[model samples]
Target: MRAVQVTEFGGPEVLTPVELPEPEPRDGQVLIAVDHIGVNYADTHQAENSYLAPSKLPLVPGGEVVGRTADGSRVVALLNGGGYAEKAVARQDWAFPVPDEVDDLTALSFIVQGSTAWLLLRRSAHLAEGESVVVHAAAGGVGSIAVQLAKAWGAGRVIATASSAAKRELALELGADVAVDSRAEDMTATLLEANGGKPVDIVLDMTGGSTTDGSIKALAPFGRLAFYGMASREQPKPVELRNLLGHSTTIAGMWLPHVFTLPGNVFGEAMADLFALATAGEIRAVAGGEYGLSEARAAHEALRARGTTGKLMLDPKR
Candidate 1:
């Protein structure tokens, strides 16, 4: 099997393509002939050992995969690791059968990016009808879907923010009511202006640093902000609980892995809903560039540089 391995902690340059022996499945696991692998920001963090969890040496840096099982079932699995290869193993419970109406890339989209977008809006933010929303980094995988989901779920207004005009334009195409500059000098003012000079009800932010601070400042009374990732590689100013008393605002943190710990089908239920939406043509997955298994380095380089939009993918068989 051909795979990309990271032996040292650094950047995209560390991902090396190599030939490795095929992995065997255990009792509860099934072997998959990988078709397409989903690349995510977490993959970059995993390669550089900057993720929430520490990674071991010689790690294969992909988690979501769309492949065929030994029984000829086409499925998508979200694994712990080792997805960047021609052959990978996934636990039976971790793999879900992809609907015939959904293509491999579309199924791959919902596993990590789509699920997070659903949980961020439906669970963490507790979105309500007729409420305003702010989606940061709105052209990326999670952001792109979040923008559409916010509107589909009956948000009164959806404001999208992105670093470039082209990305913002894509957000608007995805159903965001308004698009604003994410690199604005005053993010709070930018958001307020986009929302018709009013505070927003919900905000989904993955970019940390001042963006987080600005989102908090722009929250309306009882507004909710779901902070998920620190894409900016910077931390926001320390927050004071005392100040939250004024607006009764709430800041909730979401880590997808933790949601799995709850004794329910949270992950599965979300995946099913996303797949249905994709099948019904209610939402479309925005795809970025596709890379072969060997071009993993270039994929990571583009992702880390924020030079790509939507979902980045790798073709393991290529």
Candidate 2:
């Protein structure tokens, strides 16, 4: 099996392809012949040795994959690492059967980003029908999914923020009622106006630093701000506790791995619901680009340069 490894974290140049022995599955685990592997911002963080969790050196940096089990059944799996390979071993419980209706790359792209968007809209923020939502990085993997999920969930107004005009237009195409350049002055004001001069009921914030602070100010009373990703590379700023004095605003963080730690049935139920949504065409995974396993380095570089719009994948069999 060929895999991309980061022997020492630094930059995309560190992701070198190498041939490795195939992995065997243990009891309660399944071995997947990886067809497509999803690449995310998390992968770049891992490559640069800047992830929230400490990563071991010489690591194969991938978190989500779509492939088949030994019996040749299609499935998608979430892993701690090693997804950028031709083969991977995953816990049986962590793997979800891919529906015949979903293609391999689409299924792989949905596992991480789709699930996170589902959880954020349905669980974390408790998004309500006809309420308004504001999502950052609306052209990226999770952002694109978040926009669609927000609309499907019946959000009356969905405002998306992106860095460029092209990305802003893409966000609008993905179901955002309005798109704003977060880098512009008075972005919060623009977002509020887009929502009919009312503060949003929920904010799905991926960019931290100053943007997080601004998002807090843009929330409605009793609103929830779900802080999930930190793409801005800015140190977290202090929130004015006084800002919440008259408001019932709350800040929460989310990690998908925590879902696995829930009681057995809970994890299964949520994933099943996610799959159902995908199968029903209520949500679509955006696979931005595809590359062969050997081109993993180029994929990372694209992601690092913010050159891609949606989810990126590596086709291991190519």
Candidate 3:
């Protein structure tokens, strides 16, 4: 099987293309012929050994793939790893059938990015109708979906932040009520100004460091800030317990994998809702550049450079 492997920890340069043996499925797993593999920020962390969980050597770094099983059914599978290959194995429980109304690329989005966005707003933030929301990295995979989902759920104002003009424009096109610079020196001011000088009700933040710190200061009373990723690779300023208590604000952290552990198939339910919303044209997952299996390194480079938008994909058959 054609695949990409990371034998050493460093940067995107470490991802090397090589031929690997086919992965066999165990009793509860199914072998898939991968069509589209989802590339994510976490994949970069996995390659560099900087993810939340430590990775072993000689890793095949990808987790989401849209593929076909031996039974000829097209499905999207969330794998433990090895998705950057022509074939991969997934536990049957983690794989879901793709509706005909959904394309492979869109289905790939729902696995990691879309699911994270949904859980961030609905579960972690507990967003209410008519509330104001902020979405950082607003043109990227998760941010793009979060923007649309916030609006679809009846948010009064959706403030989007992106590093570039084009990305901000794209966020506005997607449904954000306002778009602003992600690199603003005063995030509080930028957000407040974007929201008519009012504190925001909800914030979906992945960029850490100053962004998170500033967002904490810009929250309305009882507002919720859902912290998901640290895309900036920097830690935010420490929070004061007194301030949180005084304002009655909540800062909730979300990791998609943890959502899976909750009772009642939450992960599957979110994926299904996302697919249905997408099928009905109520939500759209943006598709970014597609890379061949051998071009995995380039794909990682683009994502890390913040030069791509939406969900990055890899075509294993290429």
Candidate 4:
């Protein structure tokens, strides 16, 4: 099987094409004939060895795929690794059948990004109707999902933030009620204005640097900010508990793996909801750059540059 391998940590250049034996499914796992493999910022982190959880050596680099089984069943799976290949394996419990109404590439987008967005609202932030919600990095994969899910799930106002105007527009297309420059010096003010001169009710934040501090300061009384990823590769700016004390602002940290650990059909339930939303035309998965599997290096570089939006995917059959 053809796949991309990273033997040493560095840059995108470390992702080299190679041939490896196709993996067989373990006792409780299933083998997938992979089609489109999803690309994510996390992939870039693992490639550079900059992730909070260090990656094992000789990693295959992809964690999710939309693929098929031996009997031609369409499905999506979250792999431990080894998705950047013609074949992959995942635990049986982790694999979900792709709805007939959903296409391959769009289905691929649902694994990490969709699930995170779903969990952020349903569990993490506990967003309520008519609440104003702000989504940071609103043009990236997870951000796009967050934007759409916020609107679909009944948030009164969904504000999206991006570094560029083009990204901001894409967020609007994804159902964000407002788009603003993420690099704007006055993010708190922007949020206030978007919320009709009031502090925001919920903030879905992933960039863990300065933005975390700003979101905390912008939180309305009893507001919750769901802190998830550290895409900026910087330590989160500390928020004084005193500031949150009287306002009742709370910072709830979320990581998807932890949710997976807690139990019953979380991913499955999320995927079902995601597919229904996509099929109903209420939400659409944005498909980004399409690359041949051998072009893994280019994919990594593009994602690391933070210039791509939507779901980045690789065609293994290519």
What are the per-residue Cα lDDT tens digits for candidate 2 across 189-254?
A: 777787888888899987888778777777898888998888877866776777677788888899
* Model 4 / residue 304 / CA error / Å: 1.3
On the 0 to 100 scale, the lDDT of residue 20 in model 1 is 92
Per-residue lDDT of candidate 1, residues 284-308 (tens digit): 8998989999999999999888878
Write the number of the candidate with greater lDDT, choosing between 1 and 3. 3
Worst 10 residues of 4 by lDDT: 231-240
C-alpha TM-score for every candidate? 0.98, 0.95, 0.99, 0.97
Give a tens-digit lDDT track for model 3, residues 1-318: 899998899899999999989999999999999999999999999998888989999899899999899999999999999999999999999999999889988999898999999999999998899999999999999999999999999999999999999999999999999999999999999999999999999999988999999999999999999998898899998888999999999999998889778989998999999998998899998889899988898999998888899999998877
lDDT of each: 0.92, 0.84, 0.93, 0.87
Best-fitting candidate, scored by lDDT:
3
TM-score of 4: 0.97
Give the lDDT ranking, best first.
Answer: 3, 1, 4, 2
- Give candidate 2 misplaced runs (Cα > 4 Å): none
Q: Rank the candidates by TM-score, best first.
A: 3, 1, 4, 2
lDDT of 4 by residue, 219-293 (tens): 988999998888777777677788779889888988777777876888788989999999998888887789999
Residue 259 local lDDT, model 4: 72
